[model samples]
Target: MAKRALSVLVSGYTFLEGLRWHEDRLWASDFYTGKVIAAGLDGRVTEMAQVPQQPSGLGWLPDGRLLISSMRDRKVLRREPDGTLAVHADLTALTGGHINDMVVDRAGRAYVGNFGFDLMSGAPFRTTGLVCVEPDGAARVVAEGLWFPNGSFITPDGRTLIVNETFGNRVSAFDILPGGNLGPRRDWASFGAMPDSDDIGTLMAAASIAPDGGALDAEGAVWVADAIGKRIVRVQQGGRILEQIDTGEQGIFAAALGGPRGTTLFMAAAPNFAEHERRATRLGQILMAEVDVPHAGLP
Candidate 1:
């Protein structure tokens, strides 16, 4: 991997996450702004939907409707062709934690993850589960005992699903069984073992890797936004760091491979994830860099 400067696509966002490329547009959710946005190559921005509680992930259905994760409310909102937002799936009964990010499969089944603990309040670590929501709105927990499953991506063939466990310091892979259930699990990459400390500050300081949001490339590699490392990394199946881009002092919470040929790597950057501090300023931005491989698979 080579070190280089990333170009700024847009600025003045409160906080951005869940970046994706669809229908020639770049979509993402701005947590503090409470809006899901779409931007073009020209940098023109559009508000696609509003998520009052907080939005962290974005995806689309096979029929072209949009799916956005409502973080605080523990629900997934669907945007119809007419632009009205409605409860697509309710995940409240599946977990005691808040929902965070998701990846909708080709059949319109969505795989979602959660916070596992009260992050903003500094609660100790609590294991969480991943939920699968059918296209018709049925929901169920498919996997359990995960440590903060934050970002996810499905392979081009839709046979494998890779999820980034932020606090777990690894990216886990699962076989996508028929009807959206997860099969056997294995570590696709492991930066280190789970931290020994339960305290947030101690765990963060001692942690060597924290894989955040991610996107898959055509070459079967995943580009990850490592929040604690303050950089984006390309990882292979056996935990290899093939490429890396330093983000200087900023924290990259999420990333997506976009652009006409899908060679553009888009990153959501901020100084930190503090809610109050992010809402107080507009320092968040959508940063971009060119990569050799184009994007592949689900967002």
Candidate 2:
């Protein structure tokens, strides 16, 4: 297939992280602002809710409730329609690192990731892994030895779960059982390296590592945030780099399948953390774009 092009729809955000298309609006998390913002097709932004701790991932359950990952609190929360947040699951005991991103299945099972260690300070810590949270809130670690697991998604057929290991610079897959257990882990795709001529070195920066969030397109291509690269990469099922969508920003965090027909791709881009602290960029901006393909998996 020919490579699909990505056109920017919108920009300017403070460390955007998670992206979800609910109803007719596009919803996302602002990591630094601790708030969720909903964007309409007309480009209107509305405050959805405020999360006390930093928010990273977002999902919805079968019951129509919103699931939010409170990265700092080490817990998954159920946000009711009335604006109250309940403890969906506490993951601190199960995960050695901080929760990062997640994907919820049709049965309401949420597969989540962790930071693995202190990235900013370059501190050593135990390797992180993926955890499965049942609909009733019970949770367990299903895979380990991952280096900063970030964006993830379940295949449309519901047979495979793919997760991006940020620090490892690779995407991994797992066999999905009926009861929510992941098995037989293996590499799915790899983002080789920053151009050798660039000064960032072999590893991408904190926002890079295929960062915060991603979504699958109709052709089964994985559209990853590629945060550190300041772009989005479309990876096919066979591990091929199909296309790259540059957001024209330093800290591109997450992307989602949204817009009128679900073919439009919405990205959350922001200035670097240091730049944000210096008031050099707006805290939260929803960058918009339209892609050639539609979303493959559930929104």
Candidate 3:
């Protein structure tokens, strides 16, 4: 891991997460601020939408409608072509915790994950599941027994899916079945053995790599936000760290690769991830660095 020269694209946000590069701009859910914002390389910024219940993951329907995860309400909101938000799916009965990151495929199926426990209030650790919501608003649990499934990615061919288990210290991969169900789970990258603990703090303390959120690169490696490591890492399969961007005092939670040439890497950075710290001070920023490989696969 080497310190690299990073550029600040924009600043003043309250905990940015679920970042994605789309349509020549980077979009992210400023969760604590309850806003979905978009920013471009030209420095233009826009408030795309607002989610009162707190927005997390973001995706798009087949018809180009926007899908936003309303975390507290346990629902997925679809921004219609006319800009009116509609309830796409209610996941209250399916998920146990606050829904977070998600990735939608070409066919408009969203793969979503959650916090898995009462994070801010401090609850015991529990393995959660990954959910799938169809274009028509049908939803179901596609896979189970995940340790805080945070960010995910789908291959461009729509065959493989990758999920980052932030507390599990690994990235998991699954095969996409013909009908959108996941076949089986396997380790795409294992940083260390799974912690035999039920406490969030204990689990994090034992983790060698907290794979939080990331984007898949053209070379098949993932640019991951090493949550507890205070840096952004490019990790290859089987737990090999290819590169790292030292974020220093700032903490990175998500990364996106985009720009005219797709070489600009954007990160959702904050001083720390504490809920109180973010709400009390809007120190979140979007940081950028240049990478050799362009982005590939669905966000």
Candidate 4:
């Protein structure tokens, strides 16, 4: 396979995640910087919102409002039409650990995921639940016992939702019920079998694939960032690798499809995902690579 070159669009960030292409700009959340930013293709950057609790995932509701995942505080933020950032839903009492990523459906329902265990504290592995925050701010556990549900996307038809189970080394799919609840799940792709131990260190070492954030293309294929492999791969149904881009030294945390004609693939690359290392140095970058398939799905 011929490794393609990546062009750096922007740098000098602590860590970038939760990328989305909307309103002719690439929107992202910087973890350590505690801000949500939008960047143009010309490398110009604009600070959109300041999240003191740290923002992770980014999405938009049907009414054109922005919903952000406040990671540490376990809340979902909403940018009102008047430009005020307020708590739309609080999950501090609902979730076990930090909130990470989310995808908002057409009906304005936000599906959110959490860390499940304290990664900073080095706690043992504990499965967590995926909750759906309704437009009215009501939340409920939709699914439980997920091994670290990270990046997620809803299919274009609005019927299926796919989420990256990082530690589980697989991607899971669920049917989006009419009332915003998730149906029984099926393994979309499994890179390797899961181990028996419920330890973070053991699971991390035993897994063969660490699928992180992902983006959906027009053809229903997903481009997923492999945290452990330090690369991005375009995968079809049943785990067929179509194309891959080796990120070289940088470990890609997230990926998004954007740019003119939706042919550009944006990657959130950094040395590592550790909070201490990422905050100590501003080495995070948004790298771009042109691909054949155009984007055609929700955030």
TM-score of each: 0.97, 0.87, 0.98, 0.98
Better of 1 and 2 by lDDT: 1
Q: Please, what are the lDDT tens digits per residue for candidate 4 over residues 1-299?
A: 56677899999999999999999999999998898999999999999999999999989888899999999999999999887898999998879999999999889999999999898778888889899999978999998888899999999999999999889989899999889999998988888788898787798899877889989999999998998888988988788889989888999999999888999999999988988999999999999998989997788
lDDT of 3 by residue, 139-171 (tens): 999999999998899887889999999999999
Off by over 4 Å in 1: none
Where is model 1 poorest over a 10-residue stretch in terms of lDDT?
194-203
Clashing pairs in 3: none
Candidates' C-alpha lDDT: 0.89, 0.75, 0.90, 0.91
112-159, model 2: which lDDT tens digit per residue? Answer: 998766554445544578889999999998898776788888889999
Measured with C-alpha atoms, the lDDT of residue 32 in candidate 4 is 87
Give one clash count per candidate, in the order shown: 0, 14, 0, 0
Residue 278 of model 1, lDDT score:
92
Model 4 lDDT vs. the true structure? 0.91
Where model 2 places Cα greater than 4 Å from the true spot, the runs are: 1-12, 192-202, 205-212, 273-283
lDDT of 1 by residue, 22-44 (tens): 98989989998799989998999
